[model samples]
Target: MIAAEQVRAFRGMTRAGTRSVLIYRGDLFTGAVTLVIQVVLAIAVWRIVYSGRPPVNGVDGTTAVAYAAIAVCLQSALLPWQFSSLPMRIRTGQIATDLTRPLGLMWQALGQNLGVLLARLPLGAIGLAAAGLLGALLLPPGLSALLLAVIATVAGAMIAMLCNLIVSMVAFWTLEISGPLIVYRFGSSFLSGSLIPLWFMPDWLRASIEWLPFQAQVYTPVSIYLGQTRGAEAVALVGVQLLWLVVLTLLLQAVWARARHKVVVQGG
Candidate 1:
C-alpha cells in the first residue's frame, strides 16, 4: 500500500508539471497544427496506396486513416519530450539543487511529465474531433475495445516516460546527449510503428521489433485502436506492456543509482 504522504507528493509534482505545460499552451497548439498537417499527408498517401489494392496486408485505406488519426492525436503523450529538462538541468547545475530536494528525482520527473501529458489532452481531443469530422478518424469498434485501448495507451505512456527519463539520465555521464537523443527518437519512431504500421512490415522484422519495448509505446495501442488486437490477444499485448513497465522501472533504478553518484556540476 502507498503511503498518504507519497500520494500527496505525487499529486503536488503533477500539478507543478501541469502548470509548466499550461504555461506553454501556445507551443502545444503549434504542435497540434503540425500533427493535423501530418495526418492529412498520411491519409493522402494511404489512399493512393490502397487505390489499387484491397486491404493490403489486412489494412484498408479507411482503417489506415483511423490508425494515423489516433496515432498522431496521442503522439504527444506517446512520445513526450518534457523530461528533456534533465539534460538542461545538468548543464546549468540545476540538477545539483534537484539532488538536494527531499523527493526522489524519478518521482519528480514522472510527476512533471504526467502534468505535461494532462495539459496536452484537450488539444489531442480537439485534433481527434476534427479528424473525425473530416472522416480521417473513426470510433473504436466497440466500448470494450476502446476501454482496452485506453488502458494500453496509459501503460504505453508510462513506458514512454520511463524511457525518456532513462535517456535524460545520460546527462550525468556526458555533456552532449544529442547523438543518443537523435538515435532514440529515430528508433522509437520507426520501431514503434508510428511512421509505418508494423502489420505491413516484413514478418521477420516485425516479429523482432515486437520483442522490443518501443513497440509498446505506439504499436500496441494503435493496434488495439484499429481492433487488430482483441480478446485474449489484447490481454497479451497489454501484458507485454506491463512486463516492459516492470523491466524499464528496474532498469531506471539501476541507472539512476550509478548516475547520481557520478553527477558533476558543470557551471554555477
Candidate 2:
C-alpha cells in the first residue's frame, strides 16, 4: 500500500511533461557541455602530466583520456545538484505536505529522483559513448564488468540520496542551512574524486578520504570501472556504501518524525 503510493507519486512527477522535459533538457545540455570540457581537459592533463611518457602509474594517455571522460559522464549523469533543492523545499515549508503523504517522504523523494535519473539515462549514455569514441578511451569491459558498474552506480546514487536527505533534514532544527549545504557540495566534489581522482591525491589524504562517505558516492564506482579496485575490495566498497545508506536512512527517519511534529502546513 505504502509502496503503491510512492510509485504513484513518482509516476505523477514523471508524467508531468513540463517538469520532466525541463529536467531532461537541462541535464542533457549539461552532459553535452561537460563532455566537451572533459575532452579538452583530458588532452591538456595528459600532455602536461604524461609529457610524452607512455604511461604514468600504469595508466597511459588513452587510459587517462578514458578515465577523464568516464569521470565527467559519471559526474554529470549523477547530477549532484538535484539534492540541493531539498533545503529550499524545507525552508519554504513545501515539505510539510510531503511529510503528510501516506508513503514516507524520503521514499517519495527517492522515487522522484529515480524518475529523473531514468529519463536522463539514455541521453547520458549517448553523450558518454560519443565522448569515449572521440577521446579514444577503452570501452567499459564485458558483461560482468558492465553489470558490476551498474550495480555500483546505483548503490552510489542511493548513498548520495541518503547523504542529501541527512543534510536537508537540518532545516528542521535551523533556519539557515545554506552554509552547510555549500560546504557539503564542495566536500563532495573534491573529496569524492569528482573534481580530482583519488589516484592523484597524496597517500595520507586518499587513505583518510577512504573512511569518509564521499568516496562511496563517486570514487568507488569509477574505480571499479577502471579496474583500480576489484573482487573483494569492490564488494567491500559497495558494502560500505550500503552501510552508510542504512545509517543515513535511519537518521532521516528519526529526524523526520521530529520535524513532522513541528510542521506547520501553510496555504492549502
Candidate 3:
C-alpha cells in the first residue's frame, strides 16, 4: 500500500508542475508553432529525397512522410527541456529541499517531467496527425504494430528520463554538466536515428548502432510505427528497450544515491 505521505508528496509535485506549466504559457504556443515548422521541413526533405525516384530504399513518399511525421512527434513528446536545469538545481542546493520531501527525489522529478509531457500530448498529437493527413498516403501500421510502438515509445521516454537524471547527477562531483549533457543530447539525436531513419543507413552500420542505448530512444519505436519490424523482431526490439530501461533505472538509482550523499547544502 502507498503511504499517505508519499501520496501527499506526489500531489505537491503535481501542483508545482501545474504552476510551472502556467508560468511557461508561451512554451505551449511556441511548441505548437515549432511542430508546424518541423512538419513542413520534413515534407520538404521528403520531396527532395524522392524528387527523381519514386521510392528510396523501398520506402515511398507516403512512408517517408509518415516516418518523418512520427519521428517529429515522438521527439517533441519525449525530449526534456529541463535537462540543463537539473544540474543547476543541484548546484544551487535547491535539490536539497527536494530531497527532504517524503517522496524519492528522482521519482518526483519523473512525475513533474511526465506532467509536462502529458500537457503537450494533445497539441503534439493534433499537429502530427494534421501533418500526416496533409502529406497524404501515410503508410498505416497494423493495430498490433501500433500497440507495440506505443509500448516502446513509453519505455524510450523512461530511458531518456533516467539518462537525464544520471547526467544531471554529475553536478555533485563536477559542478558543471552542461557540456556533457549537450554531447549526450547530440549523440542521442544522431545515433538514435532521430535525425535520419536507421533503415536508410548501411546494414553493417545499422547492426552496430542497434546494440547501442541510443536506438532505444527513437529508432526502435519509429521502426515499429513504420512497420519496419514485426512479429518476433518487434518482440525482440521491445525486449531490448525494456532491458535498457531496467539497466538505466538501476544505474540512475545508484548515481542518485551517490550524488545525494555528496550533496552540499550551501544554505540552510
Q: Which candidate wins on TM-score?
A: 1
Per-candidate local distance difference test = 0.81, 0.69, 0.75
Q: Is candidate 1 or candidate 3 better by lDDT?
A: 1
Ranking by lDDT: 1, 3, 2
Residue 29, model 1: lDDT of 80
List candidate 1 segments past 4 Å from native: 264-268
Residue pairs in collision within model 1: none
Top candidate on lDDT is 1
Query: In lDDT terms, how accurate is model 3?
Result: 0.75
Residue pairs whose backbone atoms clash in candidate 2: none
Residues 1-268, model 3: lDDT tens digits: 4698787777776666556665777877887888878877887787777777877677777677677777777776666455335567766768777778778978787767666666667666866776866763355378898889889988888777677667777777887877887787777777888788888899999999988888888888888877877899999999999899888888888887776667644342
How many residue pairs clash in all the candidates, one count each?
Answer: 0, 0, 0
The TM-score that candidate 2 achieves is 0.82
- Candidate 2 vs. truth: CA RMSD? 3.3
Error of 1 at 208 (Å): 1.0
